[model samples]
Each structure stands twice: as C-alpha cells, then as structure tokens.
Target: MEAIANGLILLMLSIGHAELWTSVINRTHALKIHEVYLKRLRHVLELLMVLFPLVLLFAVGLSDPGVLVGGEWSQLPLWWQPILLLCTLGFLGLIYSGVRHQFYRPPRQQTAQESELIHLRERLKQDLIGEGPYHYLAGLPFNEIFSVEFTRKTFQLSRLPEKWEGLTILHLSDLHFSGTLKREYFIELCRIAQEMKPDLIIFAGDLIDRMECLDWLQETLGPMQAPLGRFFILGNHDWNQESLQIRQTLSETGWIDLTAEPVRLQHEGQTLFMAGTEAPWMGKLQDVKLSEDNAADDFLLLVSHTPDNFHWAEREGYDLVLSGHTHGGQVRVPPFGPIFAPSLHGTRYTSGTFFRGSTLLHVSRGVSGIHPLRWFCRPEISLLTLHSADKK
Candidate 1:
C-alpha cells in the first residue's frame, strides 16, 4: 500500500513538472538554445515518468520479508531500486532548477521577440519625436489625467468643504530618471504639474531609477516648486544603495522621504492623514503614525510603492490608498489585460481605481519605464480629485 502511494505521488509530480515546463515555453520568447533546453527538460521529464512506474513495481515486488528492509535483501533486487531512487531525485532537482532559472533569473540574451519589441519602440520614438534613428530618445512632455469624483460619503465624513471637493492630487511614480529621462522632461513635468494647479502633489516612490543619473535628476528637481506641499515615499528601487544616494540628494534639495510613516495635513479646515508603507510586502505597516487620541476621525490616505497592501489599508479603515508598481501590467493585452502584474493578486486591479468597501485603491501606471517599452499601456501621471459630500 505504501509502495502504491509513493508511485502515485511520483506520477503526479511528473505530470505537474511537465505542465510547468509547457507553461514556461509557452510564455517566454523562444531563443536558439531553447530547443536544446527543451530537449533536456523533456529528457528529464521522460526519465521521471518512466522510472516512477518501475519504482512502484519494485516497491510492490519487494514488499515481502525477502526485500532489503525485510532482512531478506540478498534475495531481492537491491541495486535497481537504489539506482532508480537516485535517478528520480536527481531528475527532480534538474526540473526544479530549470523552472527557477526560467522565471526568477534574468535572461542571458534577449530573445527575438524582445529584440523586435525594442526596434518597434525605436520606430515609435522616431515617429513621435521627428528624429533620425540615432538622434537619442528624448522625453515627450505630455499630461496624463486620472481625474475621478469622490462619493458623497467621502466628503461628509471629511470636512474638506463642498467647493473644494474637486481638488486634484497630482501623482508621479517610478521615475527611472537615468539614461532615457532627459533633463528638459523633468522640468516640463514639474511645470505641467504647476500649470494644472493641483491642490496636493504626491511622489509615490522611485524618484530616480539609476544612481548615476542622480545629479541630473537633482538639477531638474531643484527648479520644481509646487503651491501645495509635496510629499514623497521610498520605493523598492530607492532602497538600493545606489538609489539611497539619489534619495540623499533629493533630501538635501527639499524632497521629503516618508518611510512607513504618515503625516497629517490641515487643508481648508479638513484633516488629512497621509501614510507610506515600506515595500517588498513584509505585511507590516512602517512609518505610519496613528494618533491614539483621534485615530478614527482622521481621513487616512496611504501610499505604497506596490499595491500589495490594498486589503491592509481597507482593513485598517483607510479612506484612500495610492500606489504604483503595476505599470498597468506594463504591457496589457486587449481582453486578457496585463501579461505580468507583480502582485499576489495577479492582474486583478493591475492599475486604476479599485474599491475595498469605502476604501479607494488607486494604482498608477507610472511615469517612466525600466524595460523601455509599454505595448498598450502608456506612461501616466494620475490626477485624483477630492470631492466634498455636499458637492455630490
């Protein structure tokens, strides 16, 4: 009976591994060496599939006291069982390594599809900027609007007044301010923000993507002055040592870094609580200060680099949560939506506004790119308006 169970487990494991391999091949762009890798993967799978049944048979046949464990090992086929077991374990390890290699690790070389995508992006850039092939990529200064009216309940609960209800919250995130992000574009983005006359401005993590470009970003960011106070939070990218240097530069030049912390604001006689969470999803709220005297009354607004804590904010009775990191799946399909949404929730609420009861979760598509291309989803800056209860 034990032998049968072990055999069944092995069979199931074989099937599962095969499925995983199939999925990886289907999703990833094929390379020249992919065929060789595929053959090795298939060989490993076949070995497991073939050995599982044989191992089962051996275990059953050796069930009697004449087997190794039964002290009648001399009469049993001892070598075959040990050999099969060793082979199975080794093959399993190979499969595991393959899966890990394909998903977790970066690709050694760009696939044909990736190369094509780059070319396509270059073409689009040439067309958009009216430049030659090697003119260098310049930032296109464009305004991205993400305006939404608030519910009546939102205004009634918070004393922000009916007239000022439609106040805009300008949001920027994941500004990979390095090779591609030109100095002019940063100033233009800040100018646009100023021109829009936003009631509040929020920098939701990752002010710069590369550390080497910190000086350039700082030069651009220095001239950016908004009417409302600007608040910033640390992103996962910013936590890196290189990014820390950029953060220090920003810190020196009037950019506030809120790490798992919340600050209270009194705008137009309304109390607003803005909190930021430390990223990478440790499931703990950092830097968020809750006032014990009147925790419930504060119109709590939370910012996280990743939208992992949407449920967390909802459960904690937050009014609104702002986040980025999904980048609208960065590359979304028409009906199927984003191909890769980096979250526990997969593609659900990849970008835009989602409601967890009364709590609003706004995931920005982001301002720049790490991969240098977005298929369907364009780079964005979210503009959220706070409406009063009476206005509704």
Candidate 2:
C-alpha cells in the first residue's frame, strides 16, 4: 500500500509539474505571437490559456495528497515537505525565467531620428492627397502628379470614341464629416470640385463620422451639385451604434443612398451601373444583391468601404470599384507599404488603383482624418478621367 501511495505521489507530482510548465509555455507562446501578425493565432492562444488553468485544477484534484504535501511532514522527515515545496517553487521560477528569456523581451529599438524620419515619411504619404485648396493652405503635401498642375487622371475606355475621353469622375471618400473637421473644409472641397465641372461625383462612404451631426453635415453637403449625379455608400463608421438618423438625413437630401443596393445611371448613350455592398465589418447588416446580369451595361462601378469585396465586384462584372478605409496606412513605412488595410485580406489592394482581371479597383486614401492630424498618408480627392480606347 505504501509503494502504491509512492507511485501515486510520483504520478501526481509529474502531472502537476507538467501542468505548471504547460501554463508557462502557453503564456510564452502568447507573448511571442505579439511579435508576429497573427490575430487568429492570438485568439486561439487566449482560449488555450483559459483551458490550461482548468486542466491544471483538474490535475491538482486527481493528484495524491502526499504528492501535493510531499509525502507528509509526519510520515517523512519534518523538513521534507517544505524542502519539496521549495524545490517545486524553484522549478517554477526556472520555468518563468525560460519563458521570459524566450518571449517577453522586446526587439531592438531604432535610433530616435531613424524612428522620427520613418514617422515623417509615413505622414507625408498619408497627407499627400485628399485635401482641398484650403487644406493646401494649411501646408498639406500632395504628389506633384495629383497636384492642381495635373488636375486629372485619364483612363482609356476599352471601346469608345475620343469625344467621350474627357468623361470625368470626381472620387471622394471617407468624408468623416463631423465636428472634428471644420465644416468649411468640406464646403471648400465641394466648391472646388464643382468648379472642376466633373461629369459625375462618387463618394465612397463615411459621410458623417458621428451620427449626432447628421443634420449639420446634410445641410453643409446638400448644396454641392455635379452635372451627372452624386452617389454615396455606407462605410463602417457610418453606422453609429445609436439610432441610424444619418441614413434618414442623407435620403432627405437626395444623396443617392447605395448601401447594399444598385443604382443604374445612363449618360451619353452608355449605361453604367453603380453598386454598393454591405460593409464587411457590419456582417448581416449588409444588404446588397446585385448580379452581373442585372448590370448588363458598358461600365459597372462598385463602391465599397473596404477593398476585400473586390472579388465579388469583379465577379459581378464591374468595370471598376472605388473604395476607402485604408487611410494609406494613415501612416506608412517606405518600401514596407501601409501598416494595414483594415480587412481580412491584409494589405492587399490597399490605398491605390489596382487591376483585378477586367475590373479596376481604386482604393482612395480618404479626404479627412478621424483626427485633424495626418502623419504620412494624407487625405485626397481623386479626379478620374475616362479616355476612350478609339481616341488613342
């Protein structure tokens, strides 16, 4: 019976030791994951961490009493129990050291100037586009090509004539129109865009950053008119968890609300269908049901908040898709690119125009900041001019 008790004690101690080590290992693993970009892995590790403690509790319950007490003080030497406990505690300390060494320490830090310069460049890129004339007056940076000197971006239509080459589409995105930005900034941008005489105005989303300011925003944005029409879609930030009063305000002002719906526009004998999809982050709140058959036209444009929905847009036979929400990383790192896209697809198809099969996706950086400050990737207004292939 004594031998059996000894055997049980050893089994319990072994499991208990392993249980403690496993917990330390899990914590170390979680810490290591922070160094890498693995959101899913992080979640899994968190779940394992909780489960491991429960497993340890079960192990403790099943363990022999003497094993936990180290064969007892009376039965063995009086010092044995405390010594065994100390040894176990010492073992735990060793495991903690191993975990700390293997995981917790941060990577090497860059020099202050190097870090600052990196930050400066990122800010420069983010703030390079999306400001109006006054934003420039405020000392914003814009690429020379997108500056007033260039004024326009031309695209050659696959099959069309030279006369239609000047078909201009003014692309504005992520208005973030709230108290944060001066109301005049948007009014000034609208005035400037009106002066440009765009054939169409496409607003990708986030008309109001906060739902409370819908009335003020609608009044400010309502008068802005384009020769063709003004179109808008829903952005993730559009749906404030409060009541959706913004949606009602936009509808009242004749803002062609395209949240999860399709609108067809006919101009100069060519038909173009504009479709908007549900914001991916919204899950079931998205309510778009467009098919290519429904958009049987010369051109199809899909407007979305995030670009990961491009596959669906392409499959639906969209000629182009315009989106925002990357903010060009809102701060970028040279060569490394934007920090992220805010989509499950990572940084793919973020903050620029990309060709996906026959579909063209233009991911605008945005017009305003959630905060007035911009570091690298500034706000932008995109002037897209479509050129007919026949002209050239």
Candidate 3:
C-alpha cells in the first residue's frame, strides 16, 4: 500500500512539473520568441520534465529517503531539497488548474453547436501528399489530423442589430500550409467553405507556414469569396516568413487586409466594424471609440491570432471575437484535457466558444500546425451564426 501511495504521489508531482513547464512554454509562445530558440527550449524542458521527475521518484520515493539518506530529510543533498520543494509546489498548481477545468461552463450565448467529421483521405481516394513529414504518426491508429471537423455554432446575442438577425461568418484560421498535409486537403477544405456559402469569411492568421507553399493559396483560399467580404491577418508563423510578400499575395487574391486599422462596411443598411490584431507578435490592441447612440447598429468584430486577446476585446465592448493560435493544444488528453496550449492562460482558452460580458469569443481548433500530429483533437473549421436575442 505504501509503495502504491508513493508511486501515486510521484506521478502527481511529475504531472505538476510538466504542467508548470507547459505554462512557461505557453506564455513564451505568446511572445515574439524565435521559433528555433523556442523549439530548442521546448526540447530541453521536455528532457528535464522527464529526467528530474524520474530521479526524484527513484532516489526519494522508492528508497524512502529518510532511511537511505540518514534520519532527517535535510540530510539529503542541497539540490534535492529544491527539487522536492518545486515538485510539491507544482502539485499544488496542478490541483488548482484541475479544479478550474472541472468547473468550466459555456456561456448562455452559445445556443447550440453541431459537428460533422469529413474523412479527406477516404473521400479523395488518392494519396494526399504521400509520405509527408511525420507520415508514420499521420497513420497512427487513431490520429485525427486528417479528419476535419466542420462545426457550426449558434450564438444568440442580446446586443445584435435588428437588421442582422441571422448573420453567418465562416471563420478559418491557422492554415499552416506546411506541405505536411498536402495540397488536396486544403483544396477540399476550401471547396467545403464555398459550399457553406456564408455571408462573410474571415481567415484569422497563420496562412502560410512554409514559403514554398505560398503558391498553394491561389488554388485554395484565393478562389473563396463571400457576399460581404473576405478578410485576413498574418500569424506569428507567417510573420516569421516573408510576411509582406504573403500579405501582398493574399491581398491580390481578394482577401482584405484587416491587420491595419478597423474597416467599416454597410451590411443590411447598418454599419459594421471589422478589425484584426496580431498582438505580442506583430502589433498591439487597436484603439477605437464608438458613439453611444449608434451602439444599436455598429457591430464590432475583431479577429485576433491568439485568444489571449479575448479579455481585451471584451473590455473594448466588441460584439464578437475570433481567434486561433493554440490549435486546441494540437493534441488533447481526455478527462485531463489539453496539456500544452500556446497562450498565457495556458490551456484555458485553447478552443471553443466562450462568452465574456457582451463579447462572444470563438477559438478555432485550426487546420494544421508546424508539427504534424493531432491525437484526440481534430482540426476545425467554424461557421458561427449570430442571432439577435434582443426582444426589442
């Protein structure tokens, strides 16, 4: 019984250590850190997450430290003391985060959500980029990378304008375009987008991961259009590449650049605002002032590359906010949820619909990532339909 108890304690402590490091990694990704440096840091941290935990489990837990190291706990090496202290603190953090996860509840604005899974590989019948990077993992027994989830969510907003009772926006973000998933996958995704036939379309960010795949946009997102407009912003991944050229190409292809200032449009004879921010990567939150009288008609929609800006959008009185940077943690562990999300809030805003004050935030799971592996989390294309919950 003591051995089992000790093993459980060590396991929890190890999880705590990993989660604490995950927070560090998540916050670092939120900044403008170099990809190469961040990658190396992640590798080193991963090694430490394993090595440190194993050493403690074997040296202390198994041997019952007080017996092996002579009577008092302080008799152990000085280094071991700090390690033990950090482990205990990490376990506390794990318990706190776990409590938050357990109590997570969606806001009342989310009326309903429906999902459909599309199997691109079986449907296309042909090999989609045969033997791309990490092809073995792609074929893992239950890997969900290729299985796309087309989710349609309904948000009932009390502040919605009467003119736009039912407004649909197809939000597509984080199409990494790394050549790992192949061209057909993206083309098919675009085809489905066209079929949805939304009023407007928004590509949040991270359009191109590899510069070589820049031309692929012509066949994929280039042809996609909507009645209102198609707007886009560059993500950190795109910023790392030739962002100017990528922006130019996207602009030439018909998508409006929202990375600048807010754009005003006339829809249903009511004024609407569209804005984008790549904060902590490209720029900061935009400043805007709205007339109190026109609040009924002026609907502000902000596209942020990361959900970290959700609170900012809420405070700024945005009607809707769209984001996709964490990619639903790329891989999720059920019951415990996602372990590593690239946001300061850790895995809290990884993905899904969240409501804060008057703002409704939708974080997409995203199409793909730089590293091509998705276990329980499927890539998502969200179609958000906004309805007026205002009785007046």
Task: Give TM-scores for every candidate, taking all chains together and pairing residue i with residue i.
Answer: 0.60, 0.59, 0.92
**TM-score of model number 2:** 0.59
Best by TM-score: 3
Clashes of 1: 9
The list of candidate 1 runs beyond 4 A from truth reads: 1-164, 281-286, 390-392
Better of 2 and 3 by lDDT: 3
Give lDDT: candidate 2, residue 228.
Answer: 77
lDDT of 1 by residue, 12-64 (tens): 44444443443343223122223345457656655765665555445644465
Candidate 3, residue 22: the lDDT equals 76
Clashes of 2: 20
lDDT of 3 by residue, 1-392 (tens): 55566566667767778877877888898888978899999999888888877676667654645422333455567877676678778777766766766677768899988999998888898766534456566666787888899999899987678878778999999988877788988999999978999999999899887788999989999999899999998899998989999999999999899876678888877778878898878876754334345455688888899999899889988889999999998887766677788888888898888988889999999998877778889999988898989695
After superposing candidate 2 on the true structure, give the runs of residues whose Cα lies further than 4 Å from its correct spot.
1-151, 159-163, 241-243, 282-297, 390-392
Worst-scoring 10-residue span by lDDT in model 3? 64-73
